[model samples]
Target: MKKIVIAPDKFKGSLSGIEFCNAVERGIKKQIENVTIVKLPLADGGDGTVDALKFYTGGKLIAAAVHDPLLRPIQARYLYAENEMLAFIEMAEASGVRLLKNNELNPLETSTYGTGELILDAINRGAKHILLGIGGSATNDAGMGMACALGFRFFDAENNLLEGRGKDLNRLTTIDTSMVNTELRNIKFEVACDVDNPLFGPKGAAPVYAPQKGATKRVVEELDAGLRNFNEKVETQFGKNLQNIAGAGAAGGLGAGCVLFLNAELKSGTELIKSIANFDEQVKDADWIVTGEGKFDEQTFSGKVIKGVLDSRTNQQLAVFCGLSELTAEQIAAHKIDYLAEIIQQASGVEDSIKNAGKYLEEAAAQFAANGIVSK
Candidate 1:
């Protein structure tokens, strides 16, 4: 029997990684008999990281009361594995830009306090190890809001207590950790980060990502200045130069905050997830490996699940399935993609493709199996 591994990331707004795997498996089984299929759903420590890890570890999702980016009360969930004392916290659960309306996407006014609440909740419940996925953040406060939620207090030069927000960063003079949870010191935090942007510079978080979160050019400059101020304060107190750390600008400087405050280690999201899933051992002997994402572009080769899969494959023929392909023919050839399946080809348009992604994916997988898979 031919062994096939179906490893795919979540198709944002359409299907979960596991759902994608199921759809592909159903389609492939219909076209091939006498084949063993392994469904290995994957994530890059972003939106669906918790779900993917939960599926692998049989963990439970725990909901907690938390604040949103705007400091509004909301409920967010994280994956908790009791036996392992591990918690997978996707920062976007509370501070994600998707939670706000387009008109409400103001990075300067946003806060990551909600994300801190999730972390504290996990820690209170005996989570000794935290895998934090810091992506899709809405705030540009350098994690001041998150740190505040964990009992850190910010003060201005006048000794006025300040609320942690992007607008408050420029006024930050001191950080008080007197009330911080003592348990936090004993916990281990591993941040899943992919980008290499520094905390403060032309390519920093504010200038590069704040505009996407609805920042005007002026607001972007202000946010960048605030980040620099925050970094200066951190350097004065902690003696760590956060501005130069690669990936320090991720999630609106939450990456740097996790490192300095939580003593977290930053790691490639894809590689971290792959290690947890034992990806290499599982696919080392497979005859074919099928991988996919919502959009196949330059980012797909940069610390994404598809990239991790490609790097791990020894002799397996690779087939890529995506909602849309942005790669040039030369890029495809360079990556050695044996078979390319696009769900868009099986649908009417982008909207129709998204609305009926499972159906389209099934059809695409079926087409690949019938035409791309060769008899051994």
Candidate 2:
């Protein structure tokens, strides 16, 4: 029997990581009989982080009431893998932009408090190591709200409690860490992040990402100034500046808060996924690899899942095909990808394309499987 590994990240707003693997498995089995299928669901520290691990670990989901990005009451879930005593939390589930309405898209007003609540809940559950996925955040508050939830205090110029939004950080004069949960000091945190943008500057959180969360030009400027001010205050009070720290801008400075307040170690999201999925072991005897995402552009070459899959393989001549929204022949050539198939090109609209994505994926996989034998 030939061994085949069906590993893929979530399709984002379409299929979960497990579902993607199942779909791929079905397609592969249709063409190859007596094939051993290994499903390794993957994530890039975003919405599906918890689900990806849950599929592999058979973890229990614990739900808790937490605040949304806009400070609204909402329910979020975290996973606990009993065997490893590990807890997985997706920051986006608790404090992400998707939870907000159009009018509620205010970077200056949103908070990461809900994410903190989830962390505390995980700690109380006796998780020795917490894997935090830092992506798809809606706020630029420098994670002050999360710190507050974890027992840190932010005081304004008048020594009054600072409340709400990234803009409020402009008035921050001190950071009081005296009330932080001492229990958290012993726990290990692994922050999964891909981007390396720093805390506050041109390439920082506010300036680079605030606009995506509905910040106007003026709002972006205000939020940028606020983050800069917060950095200065933290430096003055804690004798540490998070400015220019790589991945510090992830989840709108949630990464920085994890590093500074939670003592977390940051790692590349794709690298972590590759390690957990055992890509090296799986690819060692594979005949070919099929990988993709929603889009395959120049960005795909920059430490994305596809890049990780390619790097794991020792055979440079191994067959690889990418399924994407659209593709330029030149772009595919630059990445050294063997073949490209555009699913969106065959659909009518965005909604239709997403609705039929699974079917299209199956078709593409079947084609790849058939081609593999012919090429051999």
Candidate 3:
């Protein structure tokens, strides 16, 4: 192929996507000689969203002082494209579950208020459209904490203002939008989400996700009840029923909250990334498309980067590579993945594979080009 498109996700504990691209490109260049290589590193609306978009738009990283999930002050960042007036905010940066320690992770007491602060900062910087990546959150307050940062006051039956937490939901009687930052209404919010869970049922936010964030069964029930109360209160106050919205459970009900309060549009993470990347324009005349991840197991069949890339483009000329893959031959045949390479298979052992991921990636790319023996 005269032109090749190399797009990949991060290797988890090893290299970032861009690092993979560079290593692969160097390797490919060693064999391909004169091919054109287009590098596009992708993310699934989670940890790597900012860097992915930054690569796409050449956006500047804007840092703001915000609170972590535990309400501690910290500096977090988002991608800002000044010319496009788009602010890319990953909620995880400000209130991600990873920010908490094992002993500190408590869904009952966490908050998304920091995310709200980031949004406010973006607005102050003249961002007209906000692209919020809602993933890896530490709170289950149904976005109440975020709303608080935007000046939406929550009150108990006694009309007493309440500090936000998952446990605070049961005490909330009504919301005060009269004090909400009116500026939020003018900003268009597009949320990047991948889950389809509802707000408060069996497959809803708390029951499905709270335990992973360190909630006990009792806390899970409490958070679920809190979401129901918040949902009912929202419907009563705003004439909007958000209980059944697909993706309502993403990031601890931040999806539902943004839709209900910020009038945000929810989109699959891949779809949103594709729009910003505009890969169609970049791949129109490409002779080959390469994509991969750390693991290509059954989960890869879902909506992760490799699947996203395959779905986004035809597979006739697509080449697949991964650190480790467990796809059956039938599955590989079904996806029409003709050119495939596994880096782990080329290593001495699993530990050696991960430790020398970049070396193996470069070698794999070169082997795919020079030898054409990827064992597809």
Candidate 4:
């Protein structure tokens, strides 16, 4: 039997990676007989990381009570593999920007304290290896909120305690880490960080990402100053200079904080997730490989699932099924894509494609199998 590997990322607001795989599998089965299909739903260390890992690895999903970005009570989940004593956490589960409304988008007030609680929960459950996906954050606290949850305390110039918000960064005068959860020192922490922005400066967290998290032009300047001040304080207290580090600005400076507080290493989110999924080994001998994202555009090559699949290809035939294709034929040819299909082209319009994405996707897959695969 021929082997087909279906690996895809989520279509953003539409279908999930797993749903994409299922729809493609169903379509493939309808057109092809005596074929083995391997479904590997993947994520790039963002909102769907835990769900993808859990679906692909059959890991246990563990939920805990935690605070949202606004410090409101909520339940969040992480993926745990007991035998490996590994916990995979998507920080967005607790402190994602999507959790807040347009009016509530103040980065100065948002907190990653909830994310820290999830990490602590995993630690308490005996996680020896913790993979933290620190993407889509709503805060600009420089991971101060997270550290506080792990028992780090911040003090102001007047010796007043701080709550670790973006507003507290400039006021930060000292850090107390003596009470941090001792277990954190024993466990290995690997942070999924793909960006290369430094902790503070023109391309840093505040200038580039603060606006998305609800900062105004004036507030952006304030956050930038705060990040700079916090970096100096961190270097003085921890003897680590995080401002110059690559990926230090990721997750509103949580990347730098992970390094300073948990001694964590920052890694490429796409590469890290692929390594965890054993993606290369799974697709090595496959006869056909299928992958995609929401839009087949330049961003698809930016450490996304399709890029991982294309980079790992050998002699296997590849097909891409996306919601829309923005890549010109020349670009597609440059990337060496064997075939491409867009659901928007198959449906009545963009709205119809999104409304019945799975249906159109299934039809596209079946047609691909019949015309593209069978014709070969």
Candidate 5:
């Protein structure tokens, strides 16, 4: 009996990580009998982290009342693991760009208030460790809402409480940490992030990502100015300049916010997932390994799940690898992946490719299992 591990990240709009594993399993079983398949979902601290953790922790999903990026009331779900007293949070659930209509993409007016509400709920539920995945954020409020929820007061130059939006960050002049949730002081916060852009500058939050969230030239400029002001104010209050910190601009500056305000430790999402998932132990005796994501471009080599999988394999001498949708021959060759295939190549059109992604994946897995001979 061959032991195979199928670990894959969510295929974005097409398939979830679990779904991908199932598809792969179906394919493998068709080609080989009595094959042991281990499914481990993966995420890069972005949209699918909570779901991935749910598989590893057997956590319960809890729904909470929160606000959207525009401060609209909404309900979002997060995961809680009673055994570990851990809460898994995906920032996208509360402030993702997907929540807004195409015409309503205004980064300046958006806020991360709902994300804060989720965190508060986790704390209230007696969670001692928070696994915060910061990705796909619709707001660039530098974590003001989260800070507010934890008892930090943001004030304007006139000494009035600042209202909302990243634009209001410019007016922020004071931060009162006295009311900060005492529970947070004793809790562990592990922030899963990947980007290294600073909080404010040419390559910072506003200029680089705010436009994608619906900022125009005018709004980007204003938001940039506002973020600069907020950074200066934060420096005055905390004696630290977060403007140039790597990963500070992740999740519309949520990375900086968590670090400066909540004392959260920032780490690569891939590393965090590997540790929490115990991927090494899972793959220790596996005969073959499969890993991929939506797109396997040059980016996959840099801090993505594929790289984590490769790194976790202690005995690199073993023939271990997987397949992906969009990988160049050269890129695949560089990784030394044992079996390489794609679903899009076999589909008729874009819609069909997406719709039949699972089927295609299954077919690819079957073919690989039949012909993917690994030499030790």
Candidate 6:
């Protein structure tokens, strides 16, 4: 029997990778006979990171009460795989932009204290290895709030405890780690990061991302200055400069915090997920692979799931089925993509396309299969 691997990333605000796999299977099975179908729902260390890991590892979700980005009490969850003693934590669960209202999207006021609490919870639960997905953050505090929750105190020049927020970073005079969780020293951290923005500058976290998180232009400048000051303090405290470290700006400098506070190793998010899934080994003999995401723009070629799947193997009959296919023919050819199946081709409008994403994805896969895209 011919074998096919159906792997897709979440469609962002619509279907998840697992849903995509099921939809595609429902369609392709209607066209193919005596074929083996493999469903591999993948994530790139974003919102669905924990779900993907839980599915792959058969891990248990540990519900924990934590604070949200705005420091309001909220509920969050993380995955713990007992066999491996690994904790898969998506930082967005505690500090995502989606948790805030439009008026409450102020980056300067948000905090990652809840994410730190989750980490501490995992540590106390006997997790020796941690994979933290730092994405979709709503703060630009240089992770001072996270540090604060981990018992790393931040004080002003007067040695008074200052609330950890973006606006307070510039006023931070010292980082005290004397009271940090004792279990932290024995744990290992692997941070999932894809962006290469530095900790502070034009392309840095505050200037590039803070505005999107609801900072005004003037506020962006202030947050950038604060991040720079935070970088200096981090260097003084850790004897390593992170101002220019690639991916250091991720998650309001939570990437840098993981490195300094937890001695984390930063890695590409998709690549890390692929490793955990054992993707290459599992699909070594697959006849064809179908993969995609919400949209396939230029950034998809850089670090997203599509690029990650393509990098895993060459000379395969791989096709991308997405909500929209923005790659030009030349770009597609350069990447050796065999076919592009876009749901928009079957749906009337973009809004309707997303509204009925499962139906469209099923139709797209059916058409692609009818044309021998996957059957061959």
- Candidates' lDDT values, in order? 0.91, 0.77, 0.87, 0.90, 0.83, 0.87
Q: List the pairs of residues colliding in candidate 6.
A: none
TM-score, candidate number 5 = 0.90
Residue-by-residue lDDT tens digits, candidate 6, 45-145: 88777777887888999999999988999999999998889999888889889899899999889999999999999988889999998988998887888
* Candidate 2 Cα deviation (angstroms), residue 107: 2.4
Candidate 2 lDDT (Cα, 0 to 1): 0.77
The deviation in Å at residue 209 for candidate 1 is: 1.9
Could you give candidate 2's per-residue lDDT for residues 170-198 as a string of tens digits?
88888887899998988989899888999
lDDT of 6 at 91: 87
Which residue runs does candidate 4 get wrong by more than 4 Å? Answer: none
Best by lDDT: 1
**Global fold similarity of model 6 (TM-score):** 0.91
For candidate 6, give the lDDT of residue 226.
89
lDDT of 5 by residue, 1-376 (tens): 7788888888888888998999988987887887788898888887677778888899999999999988889999999998999998988999899999989888878888888899999999989999898888898899997777778888887889865578788788898878888888888998998889898789999899998998888888888898898888878777889886789998888999999877899999988988888888889988888887776677777888887888887543222223344566776677777666777777887777678889888887777877883223
Model 6: residues >4 Å from true position, as ranges? 373-376
lDDT by residue for model 4 (1-376), tens: 7899999988888898899999999998899988999998888888667768777567799999999999999999889988788899888889999898999999989889999999999999989999999888999999999999999999999999999889999899999877888898899999998899999999999999999999999999999999999989878877788987999999899999999988999987777778887989999999899998888899889878788888889999999999999999999999989989999998889888998999999999999999988888
Give the lDDT of residue 162 in candidate 4: 95
Deviation from truth (RMSD, Å), model 6:
2.3
What TM-score does candidate 4 get on C-alpha atoms? 0.93
TM-score ranking, high to low: 3, 4, 1, 6, 5, 2
lDDT by residue (183-251, candidate 3, tens digit) is 888898999988899999899999999999999999999999988998888888888888879999888
Judging by TM-score against the true structure, name the best candidate: 3
**C-alpha lDDT of residue 41 in model 6:** 83
Model 3, residue 136: C-alpha shift (Å):
1.6
